[model samples]
Target chain A: MAVEPVKIKRGFQETESLKMLKESAVNVNLCYQCRKCSSGCPVADLTARDSVSDRTSAGPLDEKTGAGPDSVPEALRSGMARDSVPNSVPEALRSGMDLTPIQIIRAVRLGLEDLALNSKTIWLCTGCETCATRCPQDIDIAKVNSILRIMAYKRGIKPKLPNVAAFDRQFMANMKFFGRVYEMGLVNQLKLATRNFMQDMDLAGPMIFKGKIGFFPNFSGFLTMKKFLSRFKKARAGKN
Target chain B: MPEAIAYYPGCSLHSTAKEYDESLRAVFTKLGVELKEPEGWICCGASSAHSVDELLAAALPAQNLQLIEDMGAKEVAIPCAACFLRFKTSVYDMKQSKHLEGKVAETIGKKYGDTVTIRHPVEILEKMFANGAKNQIKKDLGKIKLACYYGCMLTRPPKVTQFDDCEDPQTMDRLLKQLGAETLVWSYKTDCCGASLALSEPDVVVKLSRDILADARACGAEAIVTACQLCQANLDTRQGQIAKKFNENFNLPILYFSQLVGLALGLEPGKLGFDKHLVDPKPLLRKYGLLL
Candidate 1:
């Protein structure tokens, strides 16, 4: 039993997500589905396969009429069947979000705000800039993804990948408290929050022995940083 | 033209990547360059900050730059690639957006004129090698093949970093070649090491780093030299896990470029802090007669 892929209406009001992407200087309209971004993406192999299988398993579509495979438009079914290897498409295109970099751009173009914001793609992005570096239209997909992450956070959307969000929150909190990232403190906080305490415990003893884990947080410029960060809060409030 | 530049040893250097900081200081000192640490510098608001709050990321590094500018230093050297990128991004963003610049200045309590230049230690070392520091190479690192891993930050989004060719950077390679080590030409030179995700998604980091290590080994590299703190830590610390997961040998020593430079300049191994690395590089160093 497979569900039909949600069909977005052809024209809709410009989405807030789309406006944010445009304001962030990402040229979402420039993407022509060249798939250059997916081809060079390092995480594409791992993420794309999962997304693609999910899409295909949800009822095969007739190529011509865009319906089910049983009542196929005949000509297009053969073509799709020929390319049904699933892994043949670029990894980014096969993503479970139904939105690789190009598809995300397209979704934004089509005003699919919730769909774009809720996708696992935003969390998985490493901000490596490989996609941006290779984008033929010179789209800064990496920056676009960053802005998306910020938007996702502001909207209070729980990330599909919880650990990454946990790490991001823990990291920022560490900086907010100590004025710098105290690794030992950060790890403890992260372990507690995520409760995966023993995940990297094997490397801990060796790291501690090597004197890499400082016992106390280095509070250099604590006062100045605290004062400075207040202004940031004010500015962010003004923006919101 | 200033003889000494301010040095910002970001949190990693103070903790996990101490060897990178120590070796950078030693190599610079040997080259007659002095590194000055600003009295009160904060974090650069690494990968985490930018994703959550844009202002915090820019303002955090802007504060450090303000401190450096206050000290009257025309330049600052950052050993960590992440810190270098943050500093560079802050300067670039401030220059582009006057509104953002004003907001950051208000936050930091100082208006940075974008005067202080942010430099990676690799850039400084490249400059030193160009300025006759090649003559100071005390020991010829004989027949030791090395893979100079630039990782992602030092050179990417070309306009921001402006360090080298974003795709196929050879700055570290050229520096190692001058140090008398055979730098291998490999495709994974600028690949992402799944930084920060080492904790959140260790599987991704392991898979990505495994490919990098396998490529280095296939390219005949005995050890991988890196300029970024995260790259060094991720590649070195995760090797045992990567090997166990993949059921393959990936015991390549991931050394900082500064450590190799320190070795070439005849600095003490103790001073270089090679003992701190999880994958002890001493065995590889001893094999190359770089250690006694």
Candidate 2:
């Protein structure tokens, strides 16, 4: 089944965010069309068509010296032996050079150019605001990249992987219906939605292993979460 | 007489992150702020819809926002950054356009009135704990330096989750102060752990997570504290694998904001879901006298 492409209009429909971004002085006109921000971007453009690099040293920055090579830190090698790389990462990008400003930015730019390829790298940005902080003219490379990632996404760039989009939806639906995230129901719905009838397959192993996934999104009553949701329905019905 | 707010908890809180849900409410109870969850609320569709369809993505959060205002709530209170950022994006869009509001409202059956407030739990927590609450903590987390990992949603897209300072948020710090934990001044508090990719792209999860862990340990933190469940899962469950695969030794623990709060509030470690984690936080809990 083909998914209808996303459509963006001149305005936002609505969102549940209360902590919206604070407005700041705009300096895009100051851009001078400078690609300095792009030049300095740590997540450089890499072609999506290229395979992932299999190198394992792309760790994040060090807290003290502030140095991490975007290498695969010690945390990524689970589930298999030391020699295996993850299925999602492109071997070229993985085995390629580290995410130096020019490298990461350039690679990402190329990868982003098509905006058809998906990788966790989009969301993988530390948002250290380093790129934003590092740009010669303060181009907000971080924000731009984030938007680009979203844009690439809006243009259909995905992670080439599964996500909690549906899980996020169901969780909110639980809150929208019950006034809180229903843990059990949420896991069940998510696994079920992803697995369809095979939902039981995903849950069976996890359930037997640790009851990790719940059948219902459980919401242990806190702060009248239940009451607030019920009242909201009544109050909402009265208005409609 | 209190102001009303809408609330949204992305999937993690419902299942893996339930402790965060429980603890956030505990903090709320102590703060005395009121939250009005919207009726017939729906999902924010985080990175999912945002990736597939902008409007479809925005509509979910829009509908939830509309319900909040329609039900008489001032705005929405989002706990998850994914939910917070996604919803806030729509709120920003609402701030910019009127037609979009009508379109989303038509689909979801709610109105995105011109005025609405979309806030994260940390924002409200900071607000409620503002008036001398920071200085009035009865408990002290003591010496246990924590790497405050904000990850992606809570910070970036500066246009969305406009909580505290985007690059360096002080809200989580304020709340941490109330909890009596010593938060390390790390640079990546607002970094992305590649959360939504945990299961789909396990490799990215491993890489991003190692960065978080490496940074935390580098900062001399005994563990990591995050507001998102995916972060918690990645740090806790995925860390072990990353360590073994990459031949890096890591014993660092991961703690939910609520678990940290539960510790400060003197709640038992067990109740905070300590046992559910693969890495042991027992020593950290012992330091706080919550483990024994």
Candidate 3:
């Protein structure tokens, strides 16, 4: 689970990517490496573990959040009330993040464009907003990740997590065509794009039997969405 | 009668999470609440638009918000937490930046102010229960130990969602308790179930989902209840794979909160779309004698 030390490419402050990131309302400079965001991030721990194939139950349970049962309201622990401290991650889950949430923020602040764009942490983020909610600086860390993802996409950085990017691309393609997500089409396209056709074939039968997968696409707003997407694309074509 | 509210099912409810669409409508009908679907509604662009282009993400939901306004309804009940978050995010972004608002207006070909209020089913139903919706319940959900999983979208980024407590939302739990079900206090309430990763990264889904389902089981929960379609689909449909991968038995049925409310209201289980769930809730419901 150890991560190699990231090489700092010197003299790259305020690169184009960093300048673009600054355009976002989020003040990346406010991040003081508080680690508060990483402390509560759910997927940060997953980055520390090996790829999915070698994963086991013991891998994720290693680094539980420091703010354990004590941070939870007394009422909630006893089942008398139903809320936990808004900022605390699960006490039993541990963190072994390769590039934790703090690191990503730091990378952005330092204009380490490559490091921030190419890290597994950005793709791993579930946009849970746990980091954003917990940050003392009021920085929307998830929004930072979102902007970084688009930047990564625009640069066509070979995704650290290709399937994740492929899925999002296929999903957007479906939205552009149908004005709605065609679940059947999206899945098939994703399978074809990722060449992962055999991955979830087992679940397909049961899903179809249960009527969970819709074979036909819904074209309710096809024309309007098509027009809207073209206009939006045309308006933003040269920018960013 | 309470004022009829607008309904935005999003795409998942029409396909993957159709049971949510069915049960929500059934429960609201039993409670004498009217639900209206906005005409020509499109997808909210879920994670895709937001991840790739901030403008399109806001614009997609902005168009739907305009439709909801055109219907003259002040509020819309979004069943999918993902859609609700997108709608809320668009409103939040537009209010925060006039430039983004102008861009979104240009993109969607519609200018919209923050005219529509977005409501989650949990919020909608809780308000009804407070106003005597409980009187309609014909049967109590006898001793069915449940964990109300409110995954990420429903209540996080408190600035945008302005929903229940971000870390530990209790609205769904309290509503179920009123229906006579035992709701457990678990720490993974607002945790991510690796949403939408089920298709892209099954390993992440299995790992994260295993943690969630295992936590519920350790807490003695016989089933898990959720208000989000992705949470339900991930936790319910991925149980067998999770069990095999983790060498654990977590055959927990992930039921939509509306399905449970429908059961409490004495609606037929068939009408609630229970059969559509991959992880069948029939045996569990039958064991509680709620299903005959």
Give me the candidate number with maximum lDDT. Answer: 3
In CAPRI terms, model 1 is classed as acceptable
In order, the interface RMSDs are: 6.4, 7.9, 4.7
Q: For candidate 1, list the clashing residue pairs, or say none.
A: A51-A95, A51-A96, A62-A67
Better of 1 and 2 by lDDT: 1
Q: Is the docking of candidate 3 incorrect, acceptable, medium or high quality?
A: acceptable
> Weakest 10 consecutive residues, lDDT, candidate 3 chain A?
A79-88
Q: Output DockQ, candidate 2.
A: 0.12
Error of 2 at A66 (Å): 24
TM (B chain), model 3: 0.97
Best by DockQ: 3
- Candidate 3, superposed: residue stretches over 4 Å from native: A1-12, A47-97, A237-240
On residues A1-240, what C-alpha lDDT tens digit does candidate 2 reach at each position? 122344334443222110111122223323444455444222333221111222224445688877443334523433223234343444533532233333334433333233222434444443434455445554454443344445554454443333434544454555555444555565566766667444324324433354345455433433344434344344434432
TM-score of chain B of each: 0.97, 0.88, 0.97
List candidate 1 stretches off by more than 4 Å.
Answer: A1-4, A9-12, A47-98
Residue lDDT tens for model 1, A103-164: 56666777776776787777778888888889889888877777888888999998877898
State the lDDT at B6 in candidate 1. 92
- For A1-240, candidate 3 gives per-residue lDDT tens digits of 354566666775777656655555678888778898986777777532222212222323224554333333321342221232111223322342457888888877776778878888788788889899999999989888888899889898998888889989999888888888889999889989999879878788999999888889989978768777787876577353
Q: Which ranges in model 2 have alpha carbons more than 4 Å from their true place?
A: A1-212, A217-240, B1-5, B33-36, B134-136, B267-271
- Against the true two-chain complex, what DockQ does each candidate achieve? 0.33, 0.12, 0.38
Residues B101-171, candidate 1, lDDT per residue (tens digit)?
87787777768778888888888898889889899998888869999999888887778889889988988
